[model samples]
Target: MLSLILIGGSIFASCRKQIAVQSIPNMPVNYTIYDNSAQAIKLAKEGMLSITNVEVENTAIGYGGLLVVSRTITPSAEDLAYDLSCPYEVKQDVRVRPSKDNSFAVRCPVCGSVFNVAENGGAPIAGPAASSNSPRRMRQYRVIRQPDGIRIIN
Candidate 1:
């Protein structure tokens, strides 16, 4: 019985998907958006934004700016925030923006890679950026819901 349990645990652990470790810098993320504000409401509805050239103390990591993506998974009404940096190219400025069609995918204009932000934790669904050897996913940040707003944190 003990061996059977151990083998079962090992099989389950081995079946788990491997998470990609990106090279992007881990800078402090402390920003809030009021729920009633236009920006916040728009983000909640649209689910994506190309926040260009944001001023942050750690300019080294996000020199180009930051991209923000929001999604409301089923079973939880709260919106989740994800960093829009392309995992393939880890730089402060290399970020992804929403497609013109407003689909679930975000495209990296620099690399021509389009990632599906709403699926599989921002996995690279298509484009020139998809490589088997590369970390092909978007970095995510922590988002906490408040009574009046949502807080983004790294």
Candidate 2:
């Protein structure tokens, strides 16, 4: 009976989800990028682009705009989209920029946190933010493929 109880407790512990150390207010994020648009064309060439949060044509640009990246050079590579806001700063104006030396990472100018944008979930890999008990990760949005282009939403 004791062994069973211990096993059950361990299972519960492992099931706990990791939570962000810092808190960021949720904001509306609904935007679409048409494949035929100039922005899409530019992204295809650059592989990365940052979009500022702005109101245009009834689309929500998200909390601090959006960071879109093409994971691979392949034409069919799926793009990943994340919020520009810095998790440690928690301010919409304070955002992370792509690392100059590494295309797969982003750095926060304010908190100095380096997030691995290329890996799973954009988790902080360096700086004070990652040393914390529960580090915060970049807020990501869902990108759904559309007939016209791609839709990003929270």
Q: Can you give the TM-score per candidate against the true fold? A: 0.69, 0.81
The TM-score of predicted model 1 comes to 0.69
lDDT of 2 by residue, 1-154 (tens): 9999999999999899766664656788888888898889887777777899464678887788898876463234677888899888888899899898777889999989998876667788998778887888888888888999888888
Instruction: For candidate 2, give the lDDT.
Output: 0.81
User: What is every candidate's alpha-carbon RMSD to the true fold?
Assistant: 5.8, 3.8
| Off by more than 4 A, model 2 | 1-19, 71-76
lDDT of each: 0.64, 0.81
- Overlapping backbone residue pairs in candidate 2 total 0
Question: Which candidate number maximizes lDDT?
Answer: 2
**Candidate 2 accuracy as TM-score:** 0.81
Residues forming the 10-long window of minimal summed lDDT in candidate 1: 56-65
